[model samples]
Target: MTDTSSAGWGLRGTAGVSFAATLEFDAVEVKLGGRVVLDHFSLTLKPGEIVCLLGESGSGKSTALRVAAGIQPVHGGAVRINGTAVSAPGLNTPPDRRGIGLMFQDFALFPHLTVLQNVLFGLRRLGREAALGQARAALRRVGLGDREEDYPHMLSGGQQQRLALARSVAPRPGVLLLDEPFSSLDARLRETVREETLAVLRETHVTSLIVTHDPEEAMVLGDRVALLRHGRIAQIGTAAEIYRQPIDLSAARFFSPLSEIESVVTNGHAPTPLGLVATPGLADGTAVTIAIRPAGGARMAILGPGTPGRIVGKRDAIGIDICEVSVEGLDLPLGLRQPSDAGLSVGQDVFVTLNREHVLVFARD
Candidate 1:
């Protein structure tokens, strides 16, 4: 039910084609070399919604994308596009007919073909004149119209990426699958291209599933972020939702470094070096692990106002000092990240304080 009239890339999608699509992986499981790569992986992307799939290497992020594009077959479960079962046990759909566009980490542009010809490669279904018009329009949409006749080798890295995107969208597919599309760009160029890419995606309204490992990238590019673990979805939510309310310690640690404390819950609370963290549903005497983020989670306090500690080590990272404080009762030094302007030094005597929201208490494994 996407409105193709204002589709983002400026090319009307294929005639009678859906402008955007609903994609689902219904408990899909993928195996390779007799090893499970996607274990009951399930996710759903709504029409025109952009979602980021995030995880560490070997966590099945790219595998999920390949499954969506029909490049990788699932050993169990099913994949659906706009409610049609495109992939399932005993059924498989060819990638070409699925109306899904794929952009790989390398951009995958044809070195010999001119930018325009590269785009036209996917539009062969249209008449030559119509295909040319669509390719040129797609090039223009991605700011590469003037480079139509230029070969892929002639363009810069960013331009080549744009050309690949133009090629992917020229056919006006209903969904776009991008695998670490910006990971290869230099930091500055990556930022610029990310913004431009997001703009086009918003304008075209193609349902997009982007796979990346960087947490910030997930937050910046996705309406919601899905984190994969061991070939399954560990947690999925808005960046703020996942960051503020992680489902477990592993989910919390995925977003940032953490200082862990082990204790037992008593009176519905888990006591830590900082304070008692609420364990609302846990029984008394239950073992628990409390975690605190180093940055903006804990801080040096007045010498007499908080738990007494000595700054045992310190290092500067991007203007923030990661101070390691040794408390008398803890086995591990607590990490406190604060602005260097605070003038904390190693061996400095100070008390430590923490915010309740910055503390997370979970059942010990």
Candidate 2:
């Protein structure tokens, strides 16, 4: 029986154990060109759940996926699929036998092969009709029911990606690995195709691992997002948990844009130009970084008189305006959302107030 335990994101029931079994990587380490790509990396991807490996370029996100997919040999570590040992030190399982499907960033579709042929490529061992039936069904699941005969160049970018997804899931592998699969598509198309791809994965109950550097993408698609830093697993948690309670300053700033202000605890609250409300238990003179979200800070007009900032500048940020406030004694930039009142301007004095409860405090390390 498949496990269906609720764990992260408040996602329960069938959505919980979407993957049939956990893909386990124990103490994995990989080196490339004499540089450590991954060091003592480890994580468990539960069944029916999409786990996103999130990081920037060369942060070892893709390398982890390759290691789990049985493509890259590990320098030292163990990889297991459904609790079955596949690789460790010297014993490496061939990619074909690993029961893994890799969705490349470029889709990796054969230019010369038709959509049907590409999907049926893995189904070749079966009879022609049987292979075509499965391929057609997979294509249909991805909403590309009528594009079977189309060549790679003939399909739109979105359609081509859908075809690639169909081909990957055609074999119904135990685990599906996506390496920045949506990176190449245009934004609108990317969202549409990603939604479609996710829906199909849900319907088919395909256990998937997606690797991407984009945080928002990770939040949208993952059952849990694991942040990798300098070749190690930094933090693995639900989107809510990671966003709400990041482990350290690095992890905190990584997922969300946060401005850290050095503050000293006075009485119960930290004394700042904005005014201290209440933050108890902090030792006196203890230095701490107060994490302020870009969207949550208040403008001087909103905070009445006695505020401590001067309007530095303002910029249009897509939908909302982002106003920068300059505060004395704080080297960090204070970010505030544009207020309705147009009273503040460059060099205009204003007071900024932080909602103390929502503010996160991290001891300076």
Candidate 3:
């Protein structure tokens, strides 16, 4: 396929046309302090595709970004942009020439330089007048055009982020990398800023890779999610695919708040207090792990007929009412979150049932 990002700009009224670009990580490997940070990591982003890279700390999320940005050296493999090998064995392309833009977690604005100057920094290849025009248009794209004359310290946290985004995109990079771009903002502001950022990215149609620890944020920003585990791509899929059908036990645990039950498969079923859950493809007598997500997936009732349980406690957790239920034959109280208007409270007698949608069965190790 042709490289769509060759145009380098968009014709948005007066702005340049933004064509998308592709990014490829071919078996990339990186080690820091003799510790392997990334191992045989391979992923690709199509032109204008937005992918969210999700991983825990020390899981090579940032290292992956640095590798693509040409700031971190790889021990093996290659990083490619627009079909060109930028980082490979004995080949390292300077970041400025990589046709990519990086928006850092700290916003990384020059404290002394005006906003327009900072945006202009990346457009140096163009003539002075053209650079000014591109910088102004970029600022306007991010809603920071009026603040071009203001210093970084003079702007709010959200505005600073917008300035940084403008600076990164002013050069009309084919690939845009954002490292925890909204982590510094408060929850309310982060949502608004994230919406704005997603809009700009879609408008420009830039291939974007966002690094975030937030699952919800990843789902909101990414067209696909690439989950990393111990320097490897554990799973790569759409939000629904990853959330609904995880690759394994660890993945299921990572995506949902689960209550674990260890059971042995018997006659193609695993018996539990809820009922006989089907265990297909597992031999009889095989040990299996059953994960149940109680929040919004387990139905609890006070009047209907079901497995009887007494509500031991209840609390409002993140806009949901999670109740502790003590069922017979169980050693611990099961945490079951109820729907809004259930009006459930502690010490109430209730019936509990597992929603098959929230249940996951995995063969034990």
Candidate 4:
């Protein structure tokens, strides 16, 4: 999983070295305006490990990060770094002394300061010469060594963001907090910047908590994803674990685009229009929701002497055709696998069949 590049200034030249650091959050909770923002939210990240708080807006993802960084006061609970209690009720430490770096979504570079100045801002307590030297080195690590004199506006969006990261980490913080770092970038540039940012972070061995709503982004960046639900963690695992074995239908859909099909579970199997799918350990007579991913290769069983379904309609998606198929009077929308100039034509009966093993079944609540 390591990438080697000739543009090397990081720990690339070293052998058997990792940026990994240990980070922990213990029963952290926060309240805003008399409402609980985070309740018993907890996660751990090993040194050089990137953990993402994955959830939608107002789900306490950012609040958790801010509290961990000591930027936001906690109403209850505690946060720790490397097992050292950093935040606890009635004991507040200033952000600068917490050894936690925060990179905001807006880059937050001082408008008047040049790129180098912004990076050197945190290092002021150190003598001027030493601070400048460290800032130069940090800028070099982010591939902006020569552009130190350029103002924040002079640099590209990605470069500006990298500057912000450099500023946050200039003091060599033990933990890094990123709040939707790539949300402001255009889609095409976001992934590239993310990759670069991750590389830089890995090089420095900074334990990072990335807050993002995009599941795919979390999958690509995090060693583990904490799916936050209503101020609590709904699921926590690697991308494959969360995607393949979600605890419920909500978690399943949150991690991936899945179509839910209602089925009656019987004898460790669920009966669907596609066929009887075996779901071992599922209680019999329980109504369950079967989650099917788009790339599961489940064929329509309505045609070709297979299962029965009526073609309801089809829509034109930029890269794919989405077909709506009704089975047993239930409308299930699925992305059709075919290429045509006109896309999927409306009203075409088709057979659909999926590997029962890939179907994720969760109790309907």
Best by lDDT: 1
Root-mean-square deviation of each candidate, in angstroms?
4.5, 5.6, 4.9, 3.6
Better of 3 and 4 by lDDT: 3
Tens digits of per-residue lDDT, candidate 3, 78-152, equal: 999989999997898999888899999999988989999999889889999999988998887666767778899
The residue-level lDDT of candidate 2 at 49 comes to 82
User: Once superposed on the true structure, which residue ranges of model 1 sit more than 4 Å away at CA?
Assistant: 1-18, 301-304, 340-342
What lDDT does candidate 2 reach at residue 234? 86
Comparing candidate 2 with candidate 3, which one achieves the higher TM-score?
A: 3
- Could you tell me which 10 consecutive residues in candidate 3 have the lowest summed lDDT? 1-10
lDDT of 4 by residue, 1-365 (tens): 44445342343322212334466777888889989999987777888778889998899998888888788877677777767777888877788887778899998889899888888888878998888877887777666788888899998887787788778767777788899999999987787778777776766777889999999999999888889999999999998888788888878778667777788888888887677778777789999887777656365643475666656776666765566666564465654443333623557666677766677888878
Ranking by TM-score: 3, 1, 4, 2
- Candidate 3 wrong stretches, greater than 4 Å: 1-17, 317-319
TM-score for each predicted model, relative to the true structure = 0.88, 0.87, 0.92, 0.87
> Candidate 4: where is the Cα deviation over 4 Å?
1-21, 300-322, 326-329, 336-349
Clashes of 1: 3
lDDT, candidate 2, at 254:
82
Q: Lowest summed-lDDT stretch of 10 residues in model 2?
A: 7-16
Q: Evaluate all candidate structures by whole-model CA lDDT and list the values in order.
A: 0.86, 0.78, 0.85, 0.76
| CA shift of 213, model 3, Å | 1.3
The positional error of residue 72 in candidate 2, measured at the CA in angstroms, is 0.7
Q: What is the lDDT of residue 246 in candidate 3?
A: 87
